[model samples]
Target chain A: MTKQLRPLMIGVVGDSAAGKTTLTRGIAQILGGDATVVCLDDYHRYDRKERKELGITALSPECNYIDIMEQHVNLLRLGQPILKPVYNHSTGTLDRPEYVAPGKLVIVEGLLSLHTPALQRCFDVTIYLDPDERLRRRWKVARDTHKRGYKPEEVLAAIERRMPDSERYIWPQKKAADLIVRFWPPYGYFDENVDNRHLNVRIFQRHTLPRPDLTAVLDHSHNGRRDAISLEKDVWSGGQPVDILDIDGTISREKAAELEQVIWEQLHFSDQLHPELLGAFSEGARERHSDPLALTQLLIVYYLLTVRKHRPVEIT
Target chain B: MTKQLRPLMIGVVGDSAAGKTTLTRGIAQILGGDATVVCLDDYHRYDRKERKELGITALSPECNYIDIMEQHVNLLRLGQPILKPVYNHSTGTLDRPEYVAPGKLVIVEGLLSLHTPALQRCFDVTIYLDPDERLRRRWKVARDTHKRGYKPEEVLAAIERRMPDSERYIWPQKKAADLIVRFWPPYGYFDENVDNRHLNVRIFQRHTLPRPDLTAVLDHSHNGRRDAISLEKDVWSGGQPVDILDIDGTISREKAAELEQVIWEQLHFSDQLHPELLGAFSEGARERHSDPLALTQLLIVYYLLTVRKHRPVEIT
Candidate 1:
């Protein structure tokens, strides 16, 4: 079994407006050619019209992905292959079959990604995105009108209907993460001009402490009580909650340098000339603190820290 | 809006393993005289194997119920109704051209009953069942073996695979409910001889708070916040956690003599001859609660509680 050990798994979770996909894409860029991105949205249980007939609105956790998460995690753990579902954000439709193979880093990203314990067990690291409510709303408006073909009013209505399920399933997942990234305006915060077109990204939580090897942590079989629910328990991570930096989104480019320096120094690995990573961070350099690139860097660090600290114990 | 009031809406929710249909049958026995029980399980997005091939599960909140819930709720809310999809639990198949009109009470029950807020908002009450895990397992085992023609090992494996989704989608629902009834035993509490034949009799969660008038609740238009989650929150019911009760398989023919008197005093109605109210507290008394009376009574009370609380806000 030791002959073919896998690298690790990581999860990025958030609501639709929470910028989970963007955050994941940027992280994948930083991880370079070695990482693979798997979106959980493809597992939706129904299409639009069917969902309408059923009298439901929005993609609540219960509406879909829960079971898919289970299956995907199993496939990932076994290092077996799977034909991942492909989804279209622009059309709000799922595409034909697609598959994914293991890579140096397997990043699972989507709504409710960390919601299940079994799925969570598959992750070496976990990250949550908590964007400013207003910014997120604005993003939704733009995305819905332009991409989803929904009017502003329709989008607003859709959002309202989703709140109950979000509270019931999505938001609570934040409490279980190794890192919680909150996007906020930097110094003289909120002074930055609002750009309805560009959504600002921020890293609210960056775990500075050394992360344990998650594989080792999850290796121990769960002999624990099945129904035991503990708010303070480490869950799959099996350690204290990691302390992380909560960065502001409105910081100046110079401030971004400082943030980047801190992150690089912590890893003790000098940043290399990976054009993709550099490009991702620089694309929104003006607001590097909040751009997708900076957010990605924060997430990558979170994943590395977790993998390094917690090692899954080998079981017979 | 005031001129077009609709019937009260009630939703029944439980996990696949939980005896939702059996519980629904009990409620139907009591309210069937004047109300209609609609089975939402019929609108499954896909069958068992189809769902598995797609790497999804039936319990997903994102199942095809969105459209079904929307259509059904609209009809009931608008004072116009139609037939609902009927799922044959025995055959594990769906039958079309089946629906229930809006009667005095519209009792909608199924796996994702409370999954969607839009659907949930249309209901006057919402109920969830949380039976003993072992009982659920055994019931599923038997059903799969005899009904679905699966071996015990296969059922066990299926159950194992489904747990993640169950925890993510179903268990969290218990917290959202107003009443949570846990069944346990020293055995002699409700009946001297515990009967394992039908685990269906257990009542796990019952929401008993009085609800607003159905029409009045549905009259209020709901427009969710922009960029909010796909989950609904406006119609949430607030109350303490559920209280657990121990009831054996056998119900006593005896009533706490004072219990009847207490119920009469609370209701302030002296109608012993009224069969409906008589069954509320008397063992083997209410025509609906007879034979399997105790279990039926448990379900009726649960059904009543939900209707009272959710009062529909407005018809679409």
Candidate 2:
């Protein structure tokens, strides 16, 4: 018997508040099996205490970029057979070292991946995200103060210190990118008078190298899943409507069982899903709950097959 | 007479340890009249003292990036600038603010400028400095330990803390760069085996953009000016070698006066000694220097022109 290894590497780069992590997770979910996400923010040369005592901001190149870039690139280039530094974002310190072996796909998202030439060369494909400044700032303001425990003033000062270095070193990498994704907040969600806008995933290399349209792929994968709805127009009173399967007593057990089988057949399968699919469906159901509609659809399908009960989605 | 206005906005981005100020001053010297250099570093929401107390790394976006970015971008975009933050890299604090109007070129360099899409769009051109990791680390260790009053462990720690943020937010911008510059240490002189390697400028840019070729431009501009050579390539080393032109000597007063005419004729148009032109030459010379080249070049240039009774480069 021969063991075949398929190695995959993905690089995501964007501004501080540009939703690189959110974007990374979306991709990981789409390609879900076993996924490990590593963020480069954990490798700061100084701790919060050290930065305060020394009246220095971490904007200059004098920070610990060399080690971070070196370690990340080395591991990535070596096919992910390594231990990576894990810093707790909440505490702003290093945590346990995590081991990441070569897998189907490895997604690395950070600011400086492309900053160093050696590191930039390690990626199979590179993505740079450009989001609206106002939206990003709002997101950053919220994330920093609420999630990261930073004061508004503190966040601002650090941004100032970092501006010059960022402009000089980082923004120029956009030209080298395979794709530049620009994100705007959902249009017309703010007010009825406002125009509804769609987020654009601009493929710069469209003429050169085109990947399958992510939205199309998502649509196909999500189609007939019993609960998913294509987000079209925003209703002020409520969000997008979802389909709920009614399990009725009038339906026979055999018909109900057949309905479950049909729903399961429509769902996408990962390589790791077991041959006996019920257990996999349960685990997948938990994840789909993160998106309400996904969970609702699965629940509706399960009701139709297991219990002949005609009931609407329970609000709770 | 009509007032000519060609708004110049210069954007500079580099990694935390990359040499930004050293590069900024290179352009400042050329445009010396009423020139102001503004650092976005001072706008950091947290001063060095506060960040250490909070025990949070200053480089993370959780700190004050939104305000700094908004203010800096607003000022530059509006052409109604402020006293930009003054972050003393040697002493980490916001000591004073200096007013900067839009110059022939307004150079803004820092880490997060590229991270912020709005800020990135504001720049006409962008640059990324790709320095050797080993060299940058050495610089960091030395600067953080000696000047910034950070212990080796502290410096290393701070760098580690900021690594993820830098990678996630900082490094990706390198792919969007208009110009990517990699510096190499100058080669050995006559003795090939003798490694007289000192840092030298090695610029890299895309074929689509106009290359910033400072050497060729300076060479042509240096004509008729005094020439000085370094004995050991210590650019700041004085008493190296100087060439002085002789047209006026100890002769009759009238004859000596005629020699001034001869000297002026040889160098035609005394108006050519405009401070702006000389300033450009000095700026170019300063950039070409490695460690002490600028200091040494000034010493040599000053000695030959003033003390040695040779042709002086006058400012009109």
Instruction: Provide i-RMS per model in Å.
Output: 13.7, 17.2
Q: What's the residue-level lDDT of B146 in candidate 2?
A: 61
Per-residue alpha-carbon lDDT of model 2 for A183-261, expressed as tens digits? 4444444332222122222223322222322233224323233312222222222352222112222223343344444
Q: How many pairs in model 2 have backbone atoms within 3 A of each other, for residues 3 or more apart or on separate chains, i.e. clashes? A: 94
User: How many collisions per candidate?
Assistant: 73, 94
A-chain TM-score of every model: 0.73, 0.59
lDDT of 2 by residue, B1-316 (tens): 3444333444567777676665556444544533345555545656678778887665666655444465455455545444344555565564433335665446677776666777766655566766655555555666666655778778777677777877886788776665555544433322323221234434444432332222321232221332111111112134333221111111233332332233333332234232222212122114232322232222222221232133222212
> Considering every candidate listed, which one attains the maximal lDDT?
1
Q: Could you estimate the TM-score for every candidate?
A: 0.41, 0.34
Report the TM-score of chain B alone for all candidates.
0.65, 0.59
Off by over 4 Å in 2: A1-3, A52-60, A153-157, A186-203, A206-316, B1-316
